[model samples]
Target: MGQGARSSWGRLLADLGSTLLEVVHGRIPADRPVGGVVIHDPVDEPVYPENSLVLAVGVHTPDALAPLLTGAGRNGGIAVIVRSPVDLTDDVRRAADDAGVAILGLARGATWTQLAALLRSMLAEDDIGHTQAESLDGIPAGDLFAVANAISALLDAPVTIEDRSSRVLAFSGRQDEADASRIETIIGRQVPDRYAQVLVERGVFRDLYQSDRPVVVDPIEMDEVVTQQRVAIAVRAGDEVLGSIWAAMDGPVTPERAATLREAETLVALHLLRVRAGADAERRLRAELVSRAVEGGPEARDALSRLGLAGRRVSVIAAAALPDEDGDASEQADQERMAARELLLDALTMHLSAVQPGAAVAFVADTAYGIIPVADAAAEDRSAALSEDFVRRISGRIPAVVAIGHAADDVAGIAASRAEARRVLRVLTTRAGTRRVARMADVETESLLLELRDLRASRGETASGFLARLVDYDRRTGSELVNTLAAWLDNFGDVPAAAAATFLHPNTFRYRLRRVAEVGEIDLTDGDTRFAAMLQLRIRRD
Candidate 1:
């Protein structure tokens, strides 16, 4: 992350500690810039970007926390967050110190998903390679957190900027000064239903939105959800209500503070527009450049340069979900498939962007492709490793295959790399196995055989010679002669193994093998004959 965008470690703790978070162990790196936030996916080996904050969701007990701290430290992580009520054993503390990662506990009510979103919103105001951020009245542009804090400072109260739906968008520090309801709202990133119901019943939202001036609400009469008085004003731009800003205060709102709240509302609206417009425009432009570059035509060179991959050797990673064998042709099913494709594409982009910063990922047609700038031809192995890790991470959730193409040295070779990557994807999708990631080199023979099968099918070919005889015999008598022969060949002529595979006694399998030879009128002893039989069996669709 750019300096214009990232938050320092000590600052994160100071800002969030009041409500949603608290450090459990290790020393804080006050100056370290947190580049990104990644959820600690326990099932898949993690990929940690430099200066990352890893959210260890569902990680309870000190034993689980200890190893995560160690791994995060080794991978350049800045900190880890587990759910609160942490045991924080001695071993966990030692591991955190050794790995140089701070373990923070999320407050009891906070959701990991919401925390991850809050952190991303903080860092993502700037682009991946953004150099410097423009400022709006001294605050960094589109930085809602800073805006919230500023409002908090001027009002001398903790603030929360919430959308019309009552979801918290950004919150200010000193939240500890607020009541339990405010704390609950911040942790969940949404107002509790009962609290929101009270507001609705009392017409608080109606009064707040209708009036331009700040509205003051009396303390709640219920349980200790709200004890502090609430001051809120709807955020707007020329009659458009963008959101609202709320401040928890002990005293009544004075004239000067009321004026300040109005001023803050206008600034907040402008910033909201800026954030939305900038993000949409940037995403469209970047997606276009990636799409064109990987497509590879007259515009490829310029597109690659724009993508920051100019003059660099690159490898392509192609990924696609295996077709669902049970798919129906309904429109809803098609829509579902398309949604799954986009989800996989987004996951690919996130994974690649974190592990390899300069890499570009985009969905081109049905395939999600990644173009990673590499050191050289040898870099394909590294690329393959990254792809494998990603596949393993998304394995059960998505039945997809990831394939690495050989390194492309220049603009001319980019298409070749993409094509080869598609070929590898083809091999993986057609075959059955737990292996979901591979490179062209690892499956060259399988790929060639697949191509041969395609050619043979296109030519209207069918099994011939002795193999055809056994097929006809099986079809006529309903015998297992051809399968028996295949099992024997598959086991390298080991009668016992072949019998085990066929669920038959060795003598019974031997009898079938003799039948195969006699029925096919073949020479079982010849190596050439066996090779031909195996090839035909593998390559023939029939």
Candidate 2:
């Protein structure tokens, strides 16, 4: 039972005790029935006459010196005296003081009012203590129950809870079978990525805090109605935000609905704080395990298992927001980052039925890091078009630069693939800007071309310094050796053809060729060396 329930019982006991005292003291009329059950106020079902005479007991020498007697007095709804006795030590006095229970050491025994005050104080302490315990679990069940019950009572509508991550945790009222099934489907499932991202990046907390108004979102405004319920309120705890509670009802919010929602908001805030604490602890633990997996090599497999992504092929994708991009740069405003995380997870499950899916995707306002699974070429080759189509559709909605990394065949190379993909992403950001796709293999050419251009740009740089100098020279003169090399390679290393095409002489062409080998510090005579250099120059040209 909740704290509210317990307090109610205590109040009932206090009432009973008061009535007994009145009867014992001959304060009530003999005609008043004492043994019959009476009910009043249908809303509360108070179960007694409002005008019943209250009773008093234990008047002298710290009445009810026994702890049990003190508790009994509370249970019986009567007031008792507090006088010095063997059991009423200094510690007891202090404890009573802490609980705000006034001790009446009445020389003429206790009065009715004294007993009533003691009962009231003890009852309040019990309720507050219950609240403190709820804070420990990250779920203020008592608070939530109060709010939910209040809302139900006020609006006659059901309310439900969703956590920081936007997953439904529980319901406030009895739901029909279909609604229950829908609730079951959503419970424990993550909140939509877009909404979560919006909340995180957009100062949604501040908005929620600054206003007493209810957040009203329509189905058309959201673009998709995934749930039957259409309303939600974010729960907050001081400066911290915990989660939200959504309600599904058949009609627009009436006065009763508004009142209930307001009360529910309070409970939602407290409960959200409690649950978030627990979730935060769990998230920290999960993050630690993921970090260990990234560092531990084979032992990392254990960590992968902990994340539920062990022994699977992995795809690491790197993406970033461009300065040219419009809208929010903060995490809260970047729905794309969050949406990308969700779409990837959902797509994997929808597309690959056989493989167990595991992913770790991060949304960092301006950039995103993702590690997911892609089955073998045979499996994904056929689906490439479909995946590409999916990406195109999404990209059309949210402009971004996305580079997919080398897909590691298994968990063993997930780390290496992620690193390579990140490097590719960096180059893409520098070279391709935003709204482009880059492959890791393609970046090598860009890097090399950049070096060659640097060498040629340097005045009188030695043949040996050609490639090394290319990098430095380009920094100085901003010339284009990589493009020149690309032209040469495209002509199959034909000097005359390359020179003619580049609008340079045969002598200059030969000089530049020799310099290319010198500056690159590698022999072009070797097929592997030539291929590497040629590949680098060509890719950069493109």
Best by lDDT: 1
Supply candidate 1's per-residue lDDT for 399: 78
Best by TM-score: 1
Clashing pairs for model 1 are none
- Backbone N/Cα/C clashes per model: 0, 32
Query: Residue 220 lDDT in model 1?
Result: 92
TM-scores for all candidates: the values are 0.59, 0.41
Per-model lDDT: 0.82, 0.49
After TM-score superposition, the amount by which residue 45's alpha carbon in candidate 2 deviates from its true location, in angstroms, is 42
What lDDT tens digits, residue by residue, belong to model 1 across residues 20-117? 67777776757767888878888897666778888988889888888988899898887898887888788988999899888887866445544564
> Over the stretch 255-361, how does candidate 2's per-residue lDDT look in tens digits?
66666676566656545433433443344445455555544476667767766677777666655543333555887666655675555434533433333245554
| Regions more than 4 Å wrong, model 2 | 1-150, 153-265, 274-299, 322-357, 363-367, 380-391, 397-411, 433-490, 493-542
